[model samples]
Target: MTTVIEVQNLTKRYKDKRALDNVSLSLEEGAIYGLLGRNGAGKTTLMSILTAQNFASSGEVRVFGEQPYENARVLDRVCFVRESQKYPDDAYPRHAFKAASLFFRNWDQGLADQLIEQFQLPMKQTIKKLSRGQLSAVGVIIGLASRADLTFFDEPYLGLDAVARQIFYDRLLEDYAEHPRTIILSSHLIDEVANLIEKVIVIDNGRILLDDDTDAVRDRAVTVVGDAEKVDAWASGREVLHRESLGRVASITVLGGVSADERAEITASGLDLAPVSLQQLIVRLTQKAESATKVIAVKEGVR
Candidate 1:
């Protein structure tokens, strides 16, 4: 696959806080990538920098073999759909679509029109007067219709109901199959987008904690259910991502895939193996650090 983006030693800081620390990653063309992390884990910062909407405190960001900022050639090939995209107070949905069509060379008016209908958008209504969900629909339509070589959607489903979100996902997959492009989706709803992404990139506390193909990342963990004691015994010495106890039964997720032999062993131990949710894994990895900090604070207070 061709490399569309190459980031090296990327670091960003805001006063005393580090937004991104020594981060380096590459994006493969014609693939869907998931940029995941906690709310303040630099997902937005990284996307903004990559899209040329924000500057990095330190680091090199290359898109299409050139810096993206004001590089017309590269910037034109990119479309960024933010969760809360801002438009003029008097601008209506139709006006936004018109602007996008002019900016993106590959923009498809037909697709935009279809998506508008699919989302049931009210084009005549001013953007500021639309519901949050309707506003999201406008951005989704632009992102899909622009057909940019590289599209960045930073949590573009805000305020969308389950039905609307499902429609968005279905349309995204359908259009993507016909028109393959590099897509970077930054969303907090990891599980919802888990099946759609080809790869996963996770950040925590301004640092990339995990980067791998979605399957490979899933393989790093497995869920087990059975007697609490048996589950605990099996999880012992293995990285337990998440664990829950219900009465005498317990479900424990461990870090690593189980080979046939391991599976047999687990079965023999009277434990059942289940698929681990990507969201669960990411939440555990990103939140553990914060939990530790809280623990330290508690200990300090006690002292």
Candidate 2:
């Protein structure tokens, strides 16, 4: 497959702090990628740069083998649906679709109309009057209808109820099956999109922490449960990820897929092996404590 997007040593800085720290990544065509990170971890910054909505401090960004900025050829094939997408205060749902038709080359009015009805979106109501869920429906409609070669959906499900969110994903998957394209989804709701994303890109502290296929990531770790002492002993020296204990029982997660011999050994020891959830793995990998300097300063100021 062709590489649809490429970034090399991309860095973005604001004042004295770096928002993106020399990050580099490549995206393959016709794949769904999950762009995930903690808040303030630069996920938005990275997406903004990729979509040419914001300038990069220093780096290389290439879409379709050419620079994307001000290049209609490259820009026309991309659509970015973000949570903070601004609209005129008096703009209604229909107005947004009208504008989308003007921008996206592959815009499908029929699909947009279908989505509007499916979500029960208010066509005449001003965007500001709609609930957060309705606002999300507006974006979701445009994102799917645009059907651009590359679509970036940045937290497009926020404020959407579980049922509404499911509708969005189900429609996305169904549409994508018939019309395959490269999709980049940046969301805090990982588990919901876990099954949808073919590739995963995890960012932490302005850097790419993990980039791997979904199955490979899942295989990277497994959890074992049994007696605390036995579990700890078996987990010792292994790449232990996260652990939990209750009474005399303990659960320990460790990195890397278990080998056949190892699994036999675990079973022989009478311990149970359980599959680890993707959300749990990501949380453990991206864990961070509050800044110490801020804590110290707050104490000093209070004193």
Candidate 3:
């Protein structure tokens, strides 16, 4: 598996704040990745820097083994689609698709046409006059049809309804199966794309919180439920992400996978294990980071 993008000790700061602080990660070719994080958690910042739309304040970044900044060879193979994608003042849907066709090396007119029809996009209307969902569809069509070797979609489903969003997903998966490439998707709709991504990279407060295979990430934590005392006993000394207690029963989510023996012990104790949703796990992790930051800030203020 060739490395498609690599960042080492990268930092991007704006005035007095750091958008990305010493972040590092490597993305392999032909893998779908979910770049998950809370709002203002550097997901967009990281993507912008990777695509050369923004520069890093320090450290290194390499795309396809070469720096991406002003590198047409590398840039042409990468396509970035975001909610705020802009076009010329008089541009129309056809204009955007035509331009994308000219830019992306592997541009497929047939795929673009298919998507436009499926999305029922109006070809003649000026882009500025199109509805929000239509605007999003333009980006989605370009992103999927461009077939760029590396693509980044930052909230590409912004104004799309459930059905349209599913269309995008279904088409993306279908095309990806026929033509495998690296794709980095950043979205607030975590559970929506949870099953689509092969790997997960979580960022929080300008730092890498978690990065691993999607399945392995799920196994990073487990939820146990039943008697409060038994649950506490089993979870004691472990990294607990969240816990809930009602009467004598408790539901505790703790870090680390349980072995078969551990499962047997849990069963013997009359405890039940439940699956944790990816969105829930990510929310808890980011919230935990936020709480810790507040605590540190409070301590510094006291000093």
By TM-score, the best candidate is 3
222: Cα error in model 3, Å? 0.8
Q: Go through the candidates in order and give each one's C-alpha lDDT.
A: 0.91, 0.91, 0.92
Model 1 has how many clashing residue pairs?
1
Give the top-scoring candidate (lDDT): 3
Task: Give the deviation of candidate 1 from the true structure as CA RMSD.
Answer: 2.2
Cα lDDT tens digits, model 1, 1-303, are 799999999998899988999999999999999999878889998998998999998989999999999999999999999976889999999899999999999899999988888889988789999999999999999999999999999898998899899999998999999999999999889989999999999988888888999989887888999999988988899977678898999998878778999999999988898986888888887766678768999999999
lDDT, residue 37, candidate 2: 76
Clashing pairs in 2: none
Model 3 per-residue lDDT tens digits across residues 79-145: 9997688888899888888888889879999999998998999998999999999999999999998
TM-score for each of the candidates? 0.93, 0.94, 0.97
lDDT, candidate 2, 96-131, per-residue tens? 999999999899999998899899998879998999
Off by over 4 Å in 2: 288-303
Q: List runs of model 3 lying over 4 Å from the truth.
A: none
